[model samples]
Structures are given as C-alpha cells and as structure tokens.
Target: MPTLDPTQLETLVVIAEEGTFDAAARRLHITPSAVSQRIRALERAAGQVLVRRTTPCTPTEAGEPLIRQGRQLRLLLAEAAATLKTGDTDDTVVDLSVVVNADTLATWFRPVLDEVATWDRTALRITVEDQGYSADALRRGEVLAAVTSEPKPVQGCTVEPLGRLRYTPGATPALVERYRKGRGIDWSAMPMIVYNEKDHLQDEVLAAHRATRPPVVHRVPSSHDFHEAIRRGLGWGMLLDAQAEADLASRTTIPLPGAKPIDIQLFWQRWRLDSIALDDLSEAVRRAARSGLRPTRPL
Candidate 1:
C-alpha cells in the first residue's frame, strides 16, 4: 500500500483551496519554495502530475482522490477535537463547507442557517450556485455536501429526496397589458427577465405558452433583484412562491393564467461520514425542506 505524508497532503489541500503556490504559502505561513518542495514530493509518491500549472491552479484527475481524502480527514479531526474537548467553554468550531442553489439560498436555506445557530460549535462556509450545478462542486470535492436537483449520488456520497420548489410565471400588470392584451400573446415584443443565462424556467414557460424564442431578455443573477426587476416592470420572469407573495396579493404581478408551475425536485447529497455535526446539519436542512417546499415522492 502507498502511504501518504500528512504534511504533504495538507500542503496539497491548501494549494487547491488557495488556487496559487504563493497564496498557499501565505496561508500556510511557509515559504513558497517549501510549498513547491512538498507538492513535488507528493507527486513523486503518487507517480503522476497531481496539479496542473494553470492560472488559479486546478487539480488533475489523480489529485482529486487525494484532495477528497484530505478534506474528509480534516472533518474527522475536527469531530475528534470536539469530542475530546467536551466543555462549556470549548471553542472548538467544526468548519463545514456546503454548496446550495441561489433560489433555495434566498428562501428556505436561510432558516437552516438559523437552526445551525443553536449548535454553537459549528461554523459554515456556503457556496451559492444553480441547483442543477451544485452537485458538480460536491463531485469535485470542493464541498462536503450539496442541495441539488440531481438525485444520483456523487460517487462516495449518499442522496435523499428533500422536496420541490415551484416557480410560477409572473409579470407586472403593465407588461401583461402590453403583451397579453387580448386573446393571444404578442410574443415578439414582450421582454423577459431571467435569473441568468443558465436559467431555463422562462424558456419552459414560453414553450408552454407556445412561443419558441423569448422576444427580449434581461438577466438578473441575484434572486431578490430578479424579483424586483419583474416588480419594477423591467421584464417578467418566473418567481418562486415565497418571493411573489406580496406582488401576487397586491395584483402588481399577475400570474399567467393556465400556466403550470415548473416544479424543481431537490435532493440532499452528502459524504457518508459518521460525523455528528454533518448529520445534524443534514437533519436541519431536511426539516426546513419538509416544512417549506412541496412534498415529493421518496426516491
């Protein structure tokens, strides 16, 4: 069996996190030459070029296993420290990294953070991205867990159904009057707002409306801003149920009649580790999802 030096593994993890040799050295409080030497020694042990010399350094295929192992080891060490230092004043914080979607982050994910506050010995680092893409971060070992649309577990991870987020097609009354004046839509003249280039909710809505292409589009990447853009009559977009509450009640944004909401099924994927902190975080998230999102059939 090939043995790894813990110091060298730590060096690799730092380099991958920092994204540059000099940055890794500064983070580790070591000389850049020392960082380079350790990485080279690791490569010699692995018998492959682990990291690519790209701008903002990326891990090669061979490096991924080492990176994942290093992160898991760190999680175990933190859990062990918390176990040994069991005292009221024990300031040992378990650092957790997780990936979540922007929409959920804007909605139910907030409540999960509130739940975490009750567990004073844990600290979180969250990455917000699209639901369809968050699992990629987990697969790359950038995060230990993720809330994603993907049901398939990332190789070493376990996955379970959370719930579903429903999006309704919404528009300001003025825009609705402008484009949907009569029996049919003036599709070519109506501009639409989207979360980003990756957002397909608008397209799905348009297709259901029997239009092939969007007339015009305004991209608002932030969830709150995206809702605001629609409310301000910049363009109509799909709004989450919670986000559209005030507007729907006030009739400021009218729902597109007969349009079915796009239901996005969400799943929780996490490394199958025995750490209590990770298990607690998952339970909190699951509870929030159950209360907030529409129930879906179990996978």
Candidate 2:
C-alpha cells in the first residue's frame, strides 16, 4: 500500500480550490515554479495524473477523491491538535468543517453564526456547495455536516430531518405576456434561464408534460442573478417561493401552468460523534427550517 503524502495532497487541494497555479502558489507562500514542480512531483508520487493545467484548471477523476480526502484529513488533524493543546493551560479552539448550499447560505444558513454567540471557544470553517451536491461532501468526509437536499444518511453519518424549501416557477407579468402571449408553455421554442447545466428543474418541468427541451437555454449561475433574470423577462426559471412571493402578490410575477410548485426537501447529515459545535449548529438550523419550511409528511 502506498503511504499518503500530506504535503502533496495539500498542494493538490489548494490548487483545485483556488483554480490557478499562481494563485495556489501565493496561497501556499511559495514561488510559482516551486508550486508547479511540487504538483508535478505529487502526480508522480501518486502514480496518477491529477490536475489538468488548463485555464481555470480542473481536477481529473483520481484527483477529486484525494483532494476531498485531503481537506477532511486536514480538518481531523486540526481537531486532534486542538484536543491535545486543551490539556495545557493555553486556550484552544476546535476547528469544524461544514458544507452548505448557496441558496440556503443566502437564505437562512448564515444566521447560525450569530445564533450561537455562546460558543465563543469554537470556530467553524465552512465550504459552500450546491444543495444538490452538498451531500457528496458528507459522503467523502470532507465536512462534518451539510445542508443538503438528500435525506439519506451517508455512511457513518447520522441523518436528521430538517424541512422542505419550496421553489416555484415564476415570471414577471410583462415577460409572461410577451412570452406566453395569452398562450402557455412551449417546450422547444421558449427561452429559459437555468442554474448552469447541472440544474434541470426547468427541463424537468417541461419534460414531465412531454415537451421538448428548450433550444435557447440562458445560463445564470447565481441564485440571486437567476431570480433577477427571470424578473427582467430574460427567461423563465424556478425561483424560491420566499424570493418570488412579494413579486407574485404585487402582480409582478406569474406562475406557469403545470409548474405550480417545486419543493426541495433539505436534511441535516452529520457525524454521529457528540460535538458541542455541531449540536449547536444543528439545533439552530432545525429551528430555522421548521419556522420557514412547509410541514413535511414522514419521508
């Protein structure tokens, strides 16, 4: 079995996260050439090609697994070091890594920091991912907890039911009139805004009705920008109800037929170990979810 090289994995993780050799080198406080050489050496040591040296570099399949593990390893090491330091008189803080979706991050997620003002001794390190993808980070052990759309538990992680976040298909009245023209959804011909290629809600809505995929797909990556784009009549998109409610009430927005509601159930998945920081965060998140989310039937 090959022994893991912490330095090499660490370098790869940094490069993947930062997306540039020079940026990663600066982050590591090393020269660009040294960074490049180290990465090359790491690829050799692992006996696998890792990062692709392209613009806004991307990791190969082999690279992703190790890079994720590297982040988790660093977090665990930090926790262990903190535990050891706590034996001394010096004050120590535990570093906890967490994953969360961007929309929830933009919505009810950040309040946990202020909500847990009591836990001054601990510091949380967060990694933001999409709700649809955050669960993968939990499976990889890249984070202790995640705000995810998946209710299923990852191996060795305990699952806790949070609540549902509802998204609705909404569009501005002017945009609706122009596009619909007193008509209805046309799968192939309509222009639609989507949350990148990974987002399939719009396509799913059309397909469920046996419609063809829209030829003109406008990609808006940010949740905020996506809402703005739809409101501006640029395209139709699935907007969170909380985001579009005001517009809907003011007659600024309209929901498309056959696309009344799209609900995304979110869950809390975390390590089974008893950690004060984790417990506190979980409680706050659950409370927020219950307050805002639609009451769910057992799932």
Candidate 3:
C-alpha cells in the first residue's frame, strides 16, 4: 500500500457506501470528475481496480479492504474527538441504528437493550427488516448493525453466527380442523396467509411436497398481525417457536404434520470499529441472541 490520501480514502468509502461516484461526489460537494480523478489516483496508488462501476456499484475484493479500513478510521476519529470534548457525548442523541426482525424484537432481543441502557450512550434507532434482507442496509451504511439471516459478512462489517430461530408450522384449532383434516393443503390447494408479496413461508412448506407454488395468498406485513391472522384462522402460517409457544400450549394452535421444519439461522453483522460503546453493544446483542434464538439441530 502506498501513502493514502485521507480525502481520497474518504471519497472511496463514500462512493462504496453511496453506490455511485456521482452520489459520492455530490455528498462531498465536489465535481463528479474530481471524484473520478481521486478514485483513479487511488487505484493507481493501490495498483488494483477498487470498484466495479455498475448500475449500483459493487466493491472489488480489493475495495472491500479499503472501505472497511476507512470506516474504522472514521469511527476512531469520531470517538477520539468525542473524548477530547468529554461533554460532547450529551450534545444530542447519538442514534445507533440497527436492523432486526419483528419477532426477535418481540422475543429476547430486548435483553440487549437492557444491556445497552446499562452503558452510557445516546438513543437507539431501530429499523425492523426481514432477517434475510438486513445486510443491504448495512452495506448502504443505513444501519450500524443488523440481525441478519445471512451468514455472509457485509462489506466493512464482521459476521457472527447468532444461532437459529425455529419456526413451527401452526394454525388455530378451528383452522386446523377445517384445513388439516384431509384438506392439509397439498399446499397448492391450501389457502395460506403470508407476511407479504415477497414472503415464502407457505412456499417453503409446499416445496416439501414438490408443489409448484401457493394458490392462495394473503399479505399481512406485521409479525404480530401475521400471528393473529393465523390464530384467527384467516390462514395457516409458520410461527416462530418463541412467539407461538404459549398459543400452541393453550391448544389454540395445531401443528402441521411431517417433521420437516424451517429454522432461520441469524447472524450479527456490525462495523468492525474499535469503539468501546460499539464493543459493549455487540456483546449485549450476542448475549441476547444466545439466549433468544434456538440452537441449530439436524432437521
């Protein structure tokens, strides 16, 4: 590595996160040509192509290292500046944004917040997303951390296996008797409620039967609403063990036949910054995930 220009390094980080050279240049109040020149200069210095310019840009393997380093440098500089002022910590709420699933929030994930409150920090800004999709937010720098279904690490982040969250195929008793007796879906004929247009809960179950696709679909976006829709017999859907246990015990739920089940393996993806505050937060989240999500077992 040759001598790095902090300005160019910042530009590269911005471009990678913002997804385009024009966007990054706009952010820095510099001309797009200037941004391009700086990037070209940086690439000459590094002797490798850093970014692959596509519709939405993607970092090369080489670019990821610089992007991650840039983020760490920025975070360390901010922490140092904050410490120098001491009182600046309380200036405004330092929002710590994170992407998490709705059920995990309703489950033991809250314990992480208890730990967060124990530390001296600012307000939390939580963004609920489907576990599978949270990594996009991390790459866009929209969130500092995420509880993701993906095991792969996002650029500028560290990935830790948080464990699996087991989901049981469940439905209300009345719904069960009405749908499970002999009607048991075959999945194609079953009327199923889904989380949204993009949800695949029913498809996952139906795929086991070698069915083509779900015939009936109802979209409810909220996890609580999704559970309630199943409980009300609107349609059957998969319920997370942590969220459905009480209902299942009270006989409100009737489990679907066949032992095959879906377990979503979650991971903690976070910026690998050396902030004491972030370290404490990562530990808290890890502890909560260990207790909240179930261990992965052979299906």
lDDT, candidates in the order shown: 0.87, 0.76, 0.77
Model 3 Cα lDDT, one tens digit per residue, 1-299? 59988788888888876889999989999999999999999899899999898968877878777775665666666666666666655453344668898878878699987866765435567898888788887875656789998888986689988888888887777765655535454556556887876677667887787766556677888888888888888877888788788998997877876626688888899987767767777888888877887865444
Query: Which residue pairs does candidate 3 place in steric collision?
Result: none
State which candidate, 1 or 2, has the greater TM-score: 1
Backbone clash pairs for candidate 2 read none
RMSD per candidate (Å) reads 2.2, 4.6, 4.4
Q: Any idea how many clashes model 1 has? A: 0
lDDT of 1 by residue, 175-227 (tens): 88887747656655689887877888788877776776565788899999999
Ranking by TM-score: 1, 3, 2
List residue ranges in candidate 2 displaced over 4 A: 1-91, 116-118, 181-183
Q: Candidate 2, residues 85-136: lDDT per residue as tens digits?
A: 6666246565567888767766766567667666655777788787788888
lDDT leader? 1
Off by over 4 Å in 3: 1-74, 85-94, 180-186, 296-299
Query: Judged by TM-score, which candidate is best?
Result: 1
Point out the higher-scoring one by TM-score: 1 or 3: 1
Q: After superposition, how far is residue 107 of candidate 1 from its true place, in Å?
A: 1.0
